[model samples]
Target chain A: MGEYILAFFMFRYLRLTLRDTEILSKWDKLLQAGMITSAVLLGVEIIFDSVSQYTTWFSYLLLGYIAYLIYWKAEFSQRKSVFVAVLPFVIVSFLTKITSLTSTEFYQSWEDVYDVAGVFSVIWMIVMLVITNKQNKALAREREKTLQEEKQNKIISQMKADLEVQVVQRTAELTKQKEELQQTLDELKNAQKQLIHSEKMASLGELTAGIAHEIQNPLNFVNNFSEVNKELLEELQEAQTNGDLEAVGDITRDIIENEDKIMHHGKRAEAIVKSMLQHSRTSTGKKEPTDINTLADEYLRLAYHGFRAKDKSFNAIFKTDLAEGLPKISVVAQDIGRVLLNLINNAFQAVKEVEKPEVVVSTRHSAEGIEVSVKDNGPGIPQDIKEKIFQPFFTTKATGKGTGLGLSLSYDIITKGHSGQIAVESKPGEGATFTIKLPKT
Target chain B: MKILVVDDERDIKLLFQQRFRKEIKNGEMDFVFAFSGEEALEFLDQLVHEAVLILSDINMPGMSGLQLLERIKTNYLEPPPVVMMITAYGDAENYAAAQRLGADDFLTKPVDFKALKEKLKTLT
Candidate 1:
């Protein structure tokens, strides 16, 4: 039972310390061969009683060889310290048995002590194996935890990369949208400029007939007087040829009067031509100090009459409330005139169909500068359209009747040209008032 | 031949008389003056068929020459006076309108009196 217990401890130590199971299995076969040799040697000693001592010595030697194989040859590194610690005790026990070979009692007592020490060493080996197994399990658990942390770290880095990609993509999309919006704004600005130019041409077309008619009067006088002078000159020559002093004097006096009349009409035509040229010229954008009241009043009547001349049935009640003692404002007169003309013309058009059509032009001294307003008692501007009224190409008038750039051009003149402010206020059914505030010099 | 000259400018009357002074003195040409289209229409009404030629301006304060041309074509059917339309501006629309109103000729200012005299001699 003791040998079997020792063999079990040796098997457990070999299984625990050997790196490969195959090496441990080979050690197992060698252990089995030594144990069978020991049993066969004991059987030979018992069968040949005459050679008992020799067979016993041989068995002892074989047992020491088996101990050397178990302790040194097999892979038992975990139990190596225990084996080294017990080596001196084993040698002392073997020496005690060898020296007291003739003293049977002493030898028997020492063998009993050796058997007890062997049992204690086997118990110590079992305890050491248990400790080594616990240490190995703790190390495996730590390694698994490290692997799991590595996997988590990889996933987190992948997520960070994905987030960076999304940020880059979003920024690119915003930049593209911004570029598209800027392009659209540029196109709109270009279209607005073209519309304003076309509207100006249309207004000039309307003014052409009135200007032509105005120039015709002076031209008629000039032609008529010149022709009459020519006939009078011929008559004066005839009177001189006939030697009639009284007839010659009358004819020469008539020719002089006709020439004076022709000169007067010629100057009138020149004045008309100068004014037309001024109207057609582009603004020099130079500032001049001018009376605000006179400027407002002149443009109002001009616009009103211009509309009336076009349509004979157009009748609008005109009213003015020009404030006295207003300071002169420095502005480009032609640009301001254009703004006023556009506003007044718009007012007249608005009130053309009203039951009590009225157009009121008011000028007054403001705290900062001068304020001019054109008000009309017509169907007022709607809320949705009021905001867009100053935008180019926005109009409520029928096609061919309006170019839709009048108010926009006016806005440009008042705001951008003169550094003034223009705004509109309206009650849907009452009327609309367009106000211009200009700076005083 | 009797002729009616219509224009808003009063100087036109003196002009016509001076240009045809010898003709008027000889009684070869008789000239009458009307200051506007309405006045010319009034003179046309009073004279009925006395005037042989009517020269009228297209633009006037009361009634345009085109309007007068329409009135003359409709009212003066029996031996209608040969009407010539005159305007300061020879615009296509006004020319077409004058023609549509049955004007005998279209003239632009300042009127060519030599051409007028040639046409007049032929008509007479």
Candidate 2:
């Protein structure tokens, strides 16, 4: 109802401003209405008449309209609040007006305005405190979130750096291992080449020596026969010139006899040379199941012949312990032949210069394989050189006497080629023994 | 019969000449000298068995004793003269190779004269 009254009064004021057609004209009407309402209410109360009371009630209606106009026009900072701040001035205006009307009854009207204003003011203070606390907590929460983000970013960067360093370290380690393996492989290839070359040279050496011995027997007879034939031919010429018929027959018989001898020895020489050529031409002859005892014996003879040609005084006595019931191994006859030849020859040479020259070749059967050993009664290999002997190009023999590749190549052939194992047992003075073991098939 | 000793080194030739002096003086043998393996081979090729034994030293600067030995054995099968190879290196592998190429005997140098005489006796 009071809001209705306020709307009515603002409309009348707006009419006055518009109709008067001047800004000052609206303010003159607003002041006139205020003074008339105040004076009319005072006169009615003084008269104590019911008819005038109705006219005085219009004054309250006018006050509600004026207050509404002022509330609408107010700024937040400069204007008094409608419900709280303005209530004090409004109570003061209501009191002074009532007091002018009835000076004794003024306290009763003052209490009504004071109650409305005081209640509104207390409500305003509670709302202000709540808004302030919420804004402050929001700001504090935003700062905490930003700090957490910074800490997360720092940790992530550190992890990235650590991962990069670890990757680099691992890559370097792999590269080092790769280089080391490559270097080892290169060295192994070089050693393999030298071993092959030495093996070829050794076989060629054997071929030549075999040829030399083979040719010697036939060549002798040829020399003897040709000389005798030449002598006989000359004598035959003399006999014809001198006219000795009987002497011619003798010369003829002598030439014929020498011719037979020539054929006999020449054929022997041819067969031997052909065989030596065939032997050297082929690499690692067809493998066969060969009795280890037989191979040992044959190579032992050849080794003996080879060494005897070099140094006749090196008559090292030989002994063999051929095991019975031993299995015949499938082997490349010539390759194994060469290995045995090298070992036996070395053994013989080792023993030849010793006080009592002696060599022993022995064969035995073991669970792993067939073991063949050649031992000598020579001054044993020095401890240092024993290990070195198995290395390519390492030799204990005097320079030019031994191509150190012999044993190293033998080791490869035995271990890698035949899938066998070779070991040496030696002492400084007792002697040395070389043993080769082949897996039992 | 006479055997020619051919080598570059004076020591090797002198050793051969001195070692066989007794047989040479007795008219049982005679010695001739050539300075190189080539000269030795040439002399032998000409005279055939006049030099029944050609003891040669390998490792000469030109035309090694081994080359001479090979030539002698391959070319002249008839009465192929006995060739004993001598070297400072008693390399058995070398010996085997020499023997394979038709070397009758092999000797390491600083040769004991007595051993040489015995080898010659077998050839004769």
Candidate 3:
């Protein structure tokens, strides 16, 4: 049935209509059925007629019909060699049947000829099956390898993307930190600028105040002396007019005394004004040869007087051990004086609360320079705040009572302004000693 | 009426004394001197507003001119004597504090003699 339908299916196979695949599969099955039928018939004829038990030749005819059917269904018309090969197979199959019925000897004579051909064909078929099976297994392994490689690549791509994201985040964080550090640096610079400006203004204010203080005293003296002179003049004129010569002499003597007093006051005030002006002028870093001992004594006395003048009721003894052979030092006299003043003032204030306060000012020549120290037997600065004393605006004084600029300004004057060294040693309740050293000239 | 000149500096008080010497002797005004604000106040306690005018330096030790002026204004309000606060520096904060404390006038050094005279006239 399939052999008869092979021509119709072949047209459909060429056109590739949707129904063609089913039709072709059905035709192949039909052809396969015919081929099996032919094989069965040939087997039946050989097995039954081996002793010539089947007297009929219809079996061979049946095999021939089956072969023809297989040929028709398989569309082997275009393969003429297949028909040629099958004809010989059919002939041998018939001859084998005839010989099996005749005798075993005749069957053995043809066996050797067909056996090799059969063996070769069988080996070729086995080779084809093995090749097909190996191709399927090899395709499966290759597909599996491709899938595994693709998975690995995907994982790598994900890791790369994640790493890129992390790097970007870290870079952004670093940039932010750098900007913050830069901003902090800017703030510090601004604060430094502000502090220096404030210092300049304070120094200028002090200078102006000092000048005003000095000028006021002398101008007052001039006005007072002139008035006194006028009074004396008028009194003398009155005595002269009345002819009381004795009164004139008395008034004249008073006038001279007042004049002398006037001169004395004028000179003192002038000295103060000039000193203030010199203080405000520019100073270079070059050290001048100065009598360190004299400067020390003057500043110590000035410090004592400054405190004594403020609180007259307090009587505190001051001991001085000024060295006699101390050599002059190279320093800025004014700057060193400021440091001495700061140290002395601190000493005095520290001892102000003590029952029996004594300040010891000692001078000696050191290997490095002339060493001068102001020591006080009073409460000392705390260890924690010792370093902070040199910091600007760090003060222990009550507001408005002290400007807190004293020690900081002194530190700058001695270290930077005079090229000298100042140090402090203190113990709580025992006392503090501030030592200053200037290089010997 | 007598006038009191209070200051720490001897030169300042003497200066005022010299400038007004003629008037003081002519029975126009008698002068008392106090070297400090404390001394001036002590004198005030004794004399009880004897001075119709008080010339004071603002920066003296013990008691400032403003403090003394406040005391006088509060304790002795009736016929409150005129107080002319004299300051070496014309510090605005101090001047403002003085004025707020009822200072009669504020003067900056070096004192203008003519201005002093005018202030004296107003006080008298």
Candidate 4:
């Protein structure tokens, strides 16, 4: 009965192990049939009191077949223990059946042998069950570890994907900010260009009256000479009709001289017009060799004459101390011309109220570079506002009298554009001097 | 009669010589030129009462025509020379100042030489 019970439990274990395998399911069914047959044969011998040798042999054969199936088809870790557990039962049953078949006298001894083998088989089965239980527990712990590793791997991958998304979002935001900054920079550049143009126009407006006077002087000469030439021609005709060859020759010479004067004055007017155009035109930012002395003298006269045109009572004695044979410096002529004009105009304004107003413009070329200075004999700048003069929109003049951009623009032209320096020296109640220094390169 | 023409423009001397060529040739008028008010004063000082008429530009660099006129009216009292002020700025303020300074006449530039010649003829 104990052997039957062990066989039934072993059959159930094999079925559980081979449940999902199609090939192993046949072994499971076979083990179940063997267990049932063994039980029925045992019941027939016990109840009918007649145990046929054939029936006994058949039952032992069925037990051996089930033991082989368990050894062949069970899970690898539990296979050895399960096969060993059923081994003792199969050997004992077979041995008992064989001895009974051999001789009747040996049947009694075989029965004793059978009982001892049964006891040993039961003990072996219990030991194999404990070993199989330990193996299953180890296998279950290994499976749990593998499952935990897979879960950690999935979580790590998810975090990496999230980080990539954050990086992409940050990159897009930076790109948008960069584009906005570039757009703002473009707007500022356009505004700077407009301001430069407007400032040039303002200076041109101040020069209009002076330019008119400059052109008018030459035009007067041209018209007067032409009128004189007409008279000389009439005089020549009279002399010819009178048959006075000497008077005719003299009058013809006079007409020639008058024509020369007209041509000279016409050329002068043309030059003044060209300069006016140059002053008003926008700068092209091209550098050319320029004579600092000539520019200084020209702007000095322009500023003086401009002031005179506006206020006939405003008069100043201007002098020049230009260095002879000074080497020409490369510069943007229009921009430098604007700076000189602004400086000279400032000097004129400084000396407007002085009793004997005097403005001196000087240019010098040294080993270092070229220098242009404008000095005035008037109330000099105070110590406090001297530093603020070059700052944009800083002016001591009345609101409408000065644009305040004159010195600031000049500062930019000399410093930023040309890589030059501009400075001022003044003694209050005495005089002020502005100096511009430019590099040779 | 001798006439003094004062202007800062050096070419005024040539212009005057040519414009009054007939008067000069006929010995009806003699012309002298000074480039500035200072030069005109120096000339008047050297040759007292020699010039009968003075034609001057108002907008000179050092001494203006009005200032010169004032000096002349104050200093040269024995039949002060007739001074005519000329300027490119024909504004009323200059005209009033010249009149107040005892100017004999005022003229705007692009000076009408024909009218000037006729006016000079009456002066002669």
Model 1 chain A scores worst on lDDT over the 10 consecutive residues at: A1-10
Question: CA lDDT, every prediction?
Answer: 0.73, 0.67, 0.66, 0.82
- Ranking under TM-score, best-scoring first? 4, 1, 3, 2
A291-404: candidate 1 lDDT, tens digit per residue: 778767656655654665586446566768999998888888767877887888888888878877888889988788999999999899999999899987788888777888
Better of 1 and 4 by DockQ: 4
Give each model a TM-score: 0.51, 0.42, 0.44, 0.71
Regions more than 4 Å wrong, model 3: A1-205, A227-242, A277-332, A340-382, A388-441, B49-52, B113-124
Give lDDT: candidate 1, residue A344.
84
Candidate 4 chain A weakest ten by summed lDDT: A69-78
Residue A118 of model 1, lDDT score: 61
For candidate 3 chain A, the 10 contiguous residues with the lowest summed lDDT are A1-10
Candidate 2 chain A, which ten residues in sequence have the lowest lDDT sum? A74-83
Return the clash pairs for model 4, or none: none
In candidate 2, how many Å is residue A43 off? Answer: 41
Q: Candidate 2, which segments miss by more than 4 Å at Cα?
A: A1-151, A154-184, A199-211, A214-287, A305-315, A319-327, A364-370, A381-428, B1-124
lDDT of model 2, residue A303: 69
Kindly list the per-residue Cα lDDT of model 4 for residues A81-113, writing each as its tens digit.
666766776677666666767876787856876
Candidate 3 lDDT tens digits, A143-183: 68888888988988998999899999999999999999999
Query: In order of the candidates, what TM-score does chain B achieve?
Result: 0.94, 0.87, 0.88, 0.96
**DockQ of candidate 3 against the true complex:** 0.17
